[model samples]
Target: MALVNDRFSKWATGFSGCDGGDIGSPHSKSIWYCGIEWGGGHPDDEHELINKVLSNDVEFPSEGYTSDDSPPGWLYNLAYRFNWQAMKLLTAVSGDSITSYKVFAEKVKPFTKGEKGYFKMNLYPLAFVNTSHDLWKNGFAKATGLDTKKDYHDWIKANRFPIMKTWMDTYSPKLIICVGKSYLPEFSLAFFGEELTFESEIIDDRELSWAVNKNGTIMVVLPFLGNRNGLNKNVSIQKFGDRIRELLTTL
Candidate 1:
């Protein structure tokens, strides 16, 4: 069963609207990494309780959002597919070799909360087992005043997108990596304040979409890193990361 307490309640209060804060540094030059949403919000899964609690506890105290180091079942654990692959991509993009696990453990440092060079967050605030799941309907309805996921999404598009734009204006990040090419509109509107036209190229038969704005922030849309159709293969992810690095140099 989903665990709810004072902490969850307090977190939901701020998280229910356009003010849902991010999970990493607010550094002006940080690389902003935007995901679809926080995963694993199923009310029935006991495994997600720790994730829920820790997510609530995350804070950005003028430095960056701080998170505890990987606990065994934590979502940030390197054992998790998403976390691992994300690290690999970041490592590769940094022009480092990804063949060694030490790239994450030593060099790139995945999920070290409050990281200065990286900023992590989601377009939507509420968590889910997957994007399509509506199990959070009841929980979010009470906190956000919109029940159906569709309504909440619409509300976020209207309200939250502007706040995101303000953040982009304020921080001026060097790179914005948005996962899920399907949410291109959301990412474009949120970060660039307009619909961005992406140039697509097929690498190893997997499509990689990217765009560069006049302000020097490059936006890239990649398939989900952990999903079935995601860039899970080492070769494909490495190639994509290299392409992103190449794009970064032009700016």
Candidate 2:
């Protein structure tokens, strides 16, 4: 069965915070992982506070209130989860360059409790969308105990992969930057076949980057960035943007 966009929508709805009542029906073109739900608030409840945060209109403390009435620790938890997912993608795309997990964390933290919450929300969704195929073929469900019925892989393959693939095939971007190392091998195997060359240069005990190109063609596996050394700390957002531009130039 071919994947379609709607099926991916359904799969995304299966997550802990994706209940439809508060979020309403997601649009086919709406940012799938951009984090802005229709009704606002956490996935479970609709609160004015949540709406404000989602809209990027949140203020540190409401007008007269001394402290926020928002759920205690929920904001932090949400931020942490979002960062984790982004890290996953970053590692997959960048490999050893991801040494500064803290860098990624700090970069994403400011967006957590603001109108850009959707940005934080979509990090995982985008990662899932980009890597869903590799994950399923590689037995990620079995290893992680993620229910095939509800997880992104099952849902995307059933619904969205075709659309995404069409987009990628058309664009054929040269560098696919993933944020976490954990996702690299699986992604490589799924997209480029199992026999492809993987030349690894280890950065530390926990992470390394393997460089490979598809059939001596345009596509190349750049280094996977991980959270390790102060790389994240040292690299500025402008520098990251420059890196992305540099990668695009190769394509």
Candidate 3:
């Protein structure tokens, strides 16, 4: 693991702080694919992710992608995992073929670290197997010096949302694809500082919604890519991506 400075470590793990950075290309008006939070990790294990954040091992918010870590095997046989689905959507948006595993492996996954034209972010920093599970909270709280998950979430809401809004204001990213419909309220509060009535449509009986900010950044909301009722089927992803591509041409 590459060594991280104290400031980076603090920014990586802290709840209420700003470091003027994110996990993507430092200078691209790229697509921002935001999720509710990272997914993975358990209660009994050592806090490997936190250690990585402090030591700069895996993907932590900074500038640009990690230098040393190899890309993860998210595209195994084109299974509809979250990251793979996101990649497929992005590829479809770019007017590329999504059916080719070789294309994704050699051409796309390598740049998903944000070297290409997209950013990966989470509204919350902690990693959980899923949102409903809470058993990992104790370990997270202990690692981050917080009392509980509620406190961590509250701090993120009060402090980090504003910072994220500032990034939106400054960068004016053309697209922010939020891939979790359940977090629409949080996405609104984070990006627009209030609840917004998003314009939505149904594809494959799944709801896909969108809202545009004053800065001309479009926030596209979709269901969880990995869960039940997700927008993971090839037809749905292709349709959604095509719609988004069409939408972008107008802006």
Please tell me which predicted candidate would have the highest TM-score against the true structure.
1
lDDT of each: 0.65, 0.33, 0.64
Error in Å for residue 136 of model 1: 4.0
Cα lDDT tens digits for candidate 3, 1-251: 22323433355444322111233333557677788886663343336535554344333344433434343332331443765677678777877766753476456543334444555678886666777645555555555555556766776677678777766776667888887898898888887777888998988898988888776778889888756668768888888888888888885
The 10-residue segment of model 1 with minimum total lDDT is 15-24
Candidate 2 Cα errors over 4 Å, as ranges? 1-151, 157-162, 189-197, 204-206, 211-251
- 169-226: candidate 2 lDDT, tens digit per residue: 4333334333344445444543344435554442323333334444222222323222
Please report how far candidate 1 places residue 174 from its true position, in Å.
0.9
Q: Extract clashing residue pairs from model 1.
A: none
Candidate 3's TM-score reads 0.77
Best by lDDT, which number? 1
Residue-level lDDT tens digits of model 1 in 180-215? 978988999988999978899998888888887787
The list of candidate 1 runs beyond 4 A from truth reads: 1-28, 42-77, 110-114
